[model samples]
Target: QKEVEQDPGPLSVPEGAIVSLNCTYSNSAFQYFMWYRQYSRKGPELLMYTYSSGNKEDGRFTAQVDKSSKYISLFIRDSQPSDSATYLCAMSEASWGKLQFGAGTQVVVTP
Candidate 1:
């Protein structure tokens, strides 16, 4: 299996829908889970970070990690057109920095 796998989705939905983006990894050594939001041609901005398996919430964004299953998810509540962007899931084994990222999922929130 690859270190990390994610579908590069062009998932389209209405503005008010709840959106979910996910990724799975093969490495058990990964200790950090992160979610990032990226606009076209721009670098991804970190959205959420979790040290281990659990849930972290910030505003309309929620990140969930399941270390036992090597699965991670990002949930966006009350989606808006502004939320339309590529969502990336990343992980790291380092205690300080450097992350390994998925290919990213593209989302379109139509008004």
Candidate 2:
């Protein structure tokens, strides 16, 4: 089984809503973390990156990591239809290709 477990949510929300996403991992060796957003038929683009147990915010997006609990989360404020995408949580013990990925959660923000 994969080291990470995440709900593959087809989470639907209205415009200007807040979008919440999370993931859990079995590996404590995971020191690096990232969140990727993938649009339909497109590659995932880096959305957030955090290395420690804390929260990081960039604009309307926030990423939180709790290493003690082996959990991580992402929040998107003021959701928009353009924000509709698949969110994949990624991690690595070292860096680069060692990344482990979670089953992406599908999100839809309706107008």
Candidate No. with top lDDT: 2
User: How would you encode candidate 1's per-residue C-alpha lDDT over 37-77 as one tens digit per residue?
Assistant: 99999989989989989999999999999999999999999
Stretches off by above 4 angstroms in model 2 are none
Model 1 shows how many backbone clashes? 0
lDDT (Cα) of model 2: 0.94
Candidate 2 — which pairs collide?
Answer: none
| Backbone clashes in model 1, listed as residue pairs | none
| Per-prediction TM-score | 0.95, 0.96
In model 1, the runs with Cα more than 4 Å from the true position are: none
Summing lDDT over every window of 10 consecutive residues in candidate 2, give the lowest-scoring window: 92-101
Ten contiguous residues minimizing lDDT sum, candidate 1 = 92-101
Candidate 2's TM-score reads 0.96
